[model samples]
Target: MDQKLTRQAASRVPRPLAQALSVVEEAAQGTKLWCGVTAALACLGGRRGRRAGTAGLAAVAVAQLVSNGMCKPLADRPRPPKGWIPHDEVEDRPDSSSFPSGHTAAAVAFAAAAAPAWPLVGALCAVPAAVVAVERVQSGAHYPSDVAAGAVIGLGAAWFTRRSPRLLRRCTSRPSP
Candidate 1:
């Protein structure tokens, strides 16, 4: 099923859209796009924007670490076969495990974390995050399940970022006997 879906996604998307998605994937290779967004928010958005940018960056970091460093090592899943993806993108695919997409994870983490700080900006971030998820499949970098897991991990990272400060405060506030 995963292979069949990957093949379909790779073949069915319109050429123009696929090209654009490929560009987006490239922009996201090292979380470059997210970092730029964070910078834009921090510089132009004033207080709330600064908070949103910081939170988004933090979540993206956590999500990238968990999806790429921890989960990828543990799962050891393989990328979709190049035969399934009828494009030059196959040559550029990562050699790493594909159980979770680091790009998707970071994208979702940034969008989710930022949304609470600034709703409008959050929604805006979500658009590209969704694009990255789709690009992962269409480019044969990940299976649908991998993208789903990445998204879940991203949400978890966002949750951790949001709660950690308070959790730390609570832990410290409890007088060590």
Candidate 2:
């Protein structure tokens, strides 16, 4: 079912839109686009933006570690069948375990983590995040389930990072010695 939906999405998307999405996908490679956005926010967006950017980048890093380092290895899911996509976009597809897309994970993690500190910036980030997720499917690089799992992982990483400081404070403020 996931593969069928992925193939349908890949096949039905118009060529121009697919081309645009391919560009988005390329920009999101290794989370470069998100990192740049985070850096800009930190540099120019003042105190709140800096905090948000830091948290967002940290969440993305955690998401990457979990999605690419752990989940992909454990699930070992294959990329969507290349044969289903009859377009040049297919050539850009990655040769990695596809479950829990690292791009989508980083995208969501960065956006969600930033939202708490800077809602507007987070909202802005969401546009590209959404595009990256859809492009993963439209390019036949990931199944729908893979994207969904990636989103969940990304959100989880953001949530965990948001709470971690309090956890650390509690552990450290124990009236040591």
Candidate 3:
């Protein structure tokens, strides 16, 4: 597939930004740091961290399932060739649909869920968010709006999950132990 003119234009991300994105991608994809970061954020809830853990888990679960399983397939977006990813810098590549970036969704959802618990750490969430957003566009995997929407979806899912405990308890309620 031919590269979108927009993607080709956006691929001009600076060298330093590209390097920074590489580092962020490495962190997010390797060692499940996203999960670890969320777990640590849950810890900030003090005794409530345990409870928050459950909610955080639910948030992350919903986000991943929605982004990777449902949205990505439905959208059927394309990815840039191996070299086209700014750092990768490819020439000819197959075109895929560019909508609703999964990486962005996952990263944003995690940030939204954990940010409430650990405000300081929550700030770091943007690092991955930015990295994934840039990486997806730079790689021709997605358009800018695709990533924006994904962020909205992911963050919205996390927000709903965080706020739904009352609903969850109401549904899961049982006789007091």
Candidate 4:
């Protein structure tokens, strides 16, 4: 099954895309940048920024956890054909499912949630997201569709969480003085 899928992807994938994926694989492979960014966002958004400052951190955590734990595990989809090739995966072969790239999900979620206040920082998150998607493809950990789906879910989660406060306020009434 995995081999058949790999052949299908190979037959259709443009050389440019494959090359780009390779580049992403190299650029972000084993980099601890994501961890640092996660920490920074958590600290900055903790109690220093605003009443809703932690939204980014919260969104990221929720997005990644769901993507990694619930969604991926439930999907239980197989990896790409070259999954055992040993060149693509940056970390351990996750026992969990692989429908959505957790790294991509977290990156996009953080970007979307934090963009309101920190445009530059949020924008930077896109780099890692793109890299993770590309790396997933190059490493044979996921198909493009999987990465795309994960990205959509992650981004959607962030957007919803970011606006949740305002939406909740509008729905609820304050006590009359």
Give lDDT tens digits, candidate 3, residues 99-143.
676667777777677667655455676677677767766655566
Decreasing lDDT order of the candidates: 1, 2, 3, 4
User: Model 4, residue 164: what's the lDDT?
Assistant: 78
Q: How does model 2 fare in lDDT?
A: 0.90
- Give the better candidate number (1 or 2) by lDDT: 1
Better of 1 and 4 by TM-score: 1
Expressed as tens digits, the lDDT of each residue in 7-69 for candidate 4 is 455455566776676565454433344455656665775543332335566677778777876
Candidate 1 residue 72 C-alpha distance from true site, Å: 0.7
RMSD of each: 0.8, 1.6, 5.0, 5.7
Candidate 3 clash pair list: 77-96, 77-97, 78-96, 78-97, 83-88, 83-89, 83-90, 84-89, 84-90
Estimated TM-score for each candidate: 0.97, 0.94, 0.72, 0.66
**Model 1 TM-score relative to the real fold:** 0.97
Positional deviation of 35 in candidate 3, in angstroms?
2.4
lDDT of 3: 0.65
* Candidate 4: Cα lDDT at 103: 65
Expressed as tens digits, the lDDT of each residue in 56-101 for candidate 2 is: 9999999999999999989988887778887777787668899989
If the candidates were sorted by their TM-score against the true structure, best first, what order would they fall in?
A: 1, 2, 3, 4
Instruction: For candidate 2, list the clashing residue pairs, or say none.
Output: none
Candidate 4 structure lDDT: 0.64
